[model samples]
Target: MIPKYNLVLCTLLALALAACQTPWVRDAQPRAGDAAPAVAEHPTATPEPETKTTPPTPAAPEARIEPAPPPDLWTRLRAGFTLPTRLDDRRVQLHLQWFKRHPHYLSRVVERAEPYLPWILDRIEQAGVPTEIALLPIVESGFNPFAYSHGRAAGLWQFIPATGRRFGLEQNWWYDGRRDWVAATDAALAYLQANHARFDGDWLLSLAAYNAGEGNVLKAQRRNRARNRATDFWSLDLPRETEKYVPKLLALREVFTHPADYGLELPPLDPDQRLELVETGGQLDLALAAELAGLPLETLYRLNPGFNRWATPPDGPHRLVLPHGASARFSQALAELPEAQRVQWQRHRVAAGDTLIGLASQYHTTVALLQEVNQLRDHRIRQGDHLLIPTARESLERYSLSAGQRKLALQNRKRAGNRQVHVVRAGDSFWDLARRYKVGVRELAGWNSMAPTDTLRVGQKLVVWTQTPAAANPNIALQRVRYRVRQGDSLARISQRFKVSIRDLEQWNDLDRRRYLQPGQVLTLYVDVTRQAGNG
Candidate 1:
């Protein structure tokens, strides 16, 4: 304020102070040890925006859980058992002791039952009977489909021929429905249900009736009522076999219920491994069926023991039970096969001495069947006439479980005596054979694996277990020869050429007499070589 230069200095100080207050000048000014700030070419450029972050939420606990798979068949069977397991009767205890002593008997039976048990259980459940009924087969036939009892009962249910027929089971040359598990099971369950109703829902009485006929059981009850005795199953006077039968079933139930307690290890069966019945649509040869199913012939026979021959019955029931896996293959293959190809056929020319009876015996067929096939009014047939015959495609021996094969096997089984083969003549009977062989009729029939009631066919072969060797007739020197049939062959021609009777050929080869001989078909002949040499 005192001098002009002083005034200029004051003005500069004021300007500098004012410049320090300006943000652009202050920010532009640099500090020690710091780099200079970058000058913005475009001062009005927009700044970048900040982003906010979010934390993740946790997952909820699992809400649904799957149920555990059902237990094995044995466990399920035990759980479903509804029989009276608390029987204190001595008969039941006796059987229980027997079972405990012979554990392997049950083991073997269970092994055989594996293929059948699941289906049986399903049927039993559906039938609404006590699950214990499934064990009845164990007592009856040991669950054997091929079981033929001394009492003429057959199959797992052990139905006699009469009972089988009453239950609509057919017994024929081609099939025995008594041996069919499916048919027999249905028949047996139906019979049991009927008995159950008849006996006023008494399962024990019904079971006893099954062993001894319902008529017998009713008669026993009637007698008990007359005597003023308790008419319970235990109180009634039943057959000895029937008395043991009901208790045997109950003991099996107890053991099966607590197998571990009895120290029994039931055979392990996969519940899922099961059999299914598939319809074959028509008469199908068992050999071809087995081939189509990719199964062994023996396996097919075991599963379907109903069939008695190489082919199923021509009339009906054209069904086969196969493993679940093989059903599709078999059904498809069967659908494509022609009906003409279902059975093998052969043509035969009638020769001299070719009577219908002789031809039927030779080809293992019936006179009626021959007449039907040949369109003959009478048993008469002219020489040099051609006839068509149905024949097995495979060799007879290949049908290991066929009726003839089974009989052959039984006959060939070694016993404790000198084995003699007797060719049955027209007049032969069980009584006649028993007298000739110096053996009981029952024993002779049994030796041949036949019931005394079974008919003896002419030219049938019977095995005699004799204490002494059979005397050889000088006129009948015999030799076994396997001869293959040639074209234009006939039973009469073969018989004459070989110097053997047609009956002998039939017996030796198990030939069906009504069928024609095929070219290249092998025939077993018991040729009289001595007679042949004499004739030559």
Candidate 2:
């Protein structure tokens, strides 16, 4: 019985050890049929990325970025049109090549003239023309306001005088709207609009017409059409200058459009550069306007390109352009200058190839007088330069009975110490002349002795002034200085000591004092530096 008990105990111990070794048998486990319920929230769990199932390839990262928005409908439509930007060398070489020789002309233009980019851009945009067209000026006249083509085109926009007049541009001796910034801008825009309408809104053709005239462009188109060739500017056989004219404008446009692409650094335009057009009823000074408006004088000069002088005329509707913020002040100040001081004036912008003399001829003023009044010491006024001019008044009444109006006036005036005469131009008449010269018809007749029925011929000179032209005889006189004689000098010794003439000493010095011959007596002498240098 004891042996059986020991065997049973050992068996029981062995069973316990086996149960310990297989712990899975005692612990709870998840069965496939009874899996643990999934939790709704778990701190340690991470969600999968909510993106495209497959990522983009390494080669095209940009593919993931959205492309730039398409240009608006207007932009797309405008892109179809192109204006003259530059000359096509193969199609036309003469004028284009000739102008290219003066490559620095453009740079010089930008330097002297106030930047018209702001005002010009605004006006072009207003006319529905692209801002790119502003660059067309570089090709037209190299941005010269006074550029005159062999074809008779003038102004920055190259409007012919007649065409400029047709567009209501003023063409008087006092003012040529062709050179007036505001008026020329309006005329050019109108002409361009007309050309565009005539060409059915084909800007390129309109531009071509503008350069070569509508008649020439129409002829070219008809010729090309008859030959079954394209009517595009590229195919038309335009004049040499006209052919390259478009291309030159395009080259400038290309440069302006993507300056960075061409490695050119264009300063970003300032917002303040924008201008607002306002009319003036009377004269105003630019300096005063600039001060009232808190603007720089250079800025005013740029903003108002019409005034050819420093002061705006007080005459009716002088048409002054003030800064964006100063129109009110300008008008108020215009009311302040004396009414008599208010002279009729028109503004003119300086153009390339223009000199003080050329401007004087245009305005009917002497260059010397222009310089004298404007305080200009130099002859280098530039394109886009502005000037103020005092309108010419009519001649005096006494000069109406003379035969050779100019000669009679001059003779009468020379007899009366009159000195200068100016020729009557295309738009001059007795009334305009009288007002311009500030003389009545009778005074003019008395001055020049002109007959009442004698019509002034083109290029015929008329007496303009009663004073002898100072320019005719310059005031070239020596300066005189007086000095007191000292105790140690004799008359001959004093003459030799100061290197002066005895005769001049006698003439300049007091003879009575010389007779007194006292020490420390004052003596006067004339020393002509020019004469002294000549003697030396």
Per-residue C-alpha lDDT of model 2 across residues 143-238, encoded as one tens digit per residue: 655444544565677777678878987654334567566677777888888988998887878888888889999998899999999997788998
Q: Positional deviation of 139 in candidate 1, in angstroms?
A: 1.4
**Top candidate when judged by lDDT against the true structure:** 1
Quantify how close model 1 is to the true structure by its C-alpha RMSD in Å: 15.9
Q: What lDDT tens digits, residue by residue, belong to model 1 across residues 1-536?
A: 24776667666665655465565665555555578566433222223356744344333334457999878778878777876664689999999888888888888899889888889988998898998999999999998888877677888999999999999999987889999999999999999999999999989999999999999999999999999999889899998999999889989999998887677897667645579999988777789999999999998998999988888887758899999989999889888888899888789898754656656666655566677777889766667899886778888899999877887898898988778877665456888878876788878887776788778875467888877665553312444566778899999998889866787677655566898887766676655566676433
Please provide TM-scores, in order, for all candidate models, with all chains considered together: 0.75, 0.46
User: Which ranges in model 2 have alpha carbons more than 4 Å from their true place?
Assistant: 1-114, 146-152, 261-263, 283-302, 307-316, 325-332, 335-536
**TM-score (C-alpha, index-matched) for candidate 1:** 0.75
Which ten-residue region of model 2 has the weakest summed lDDT? 396-405
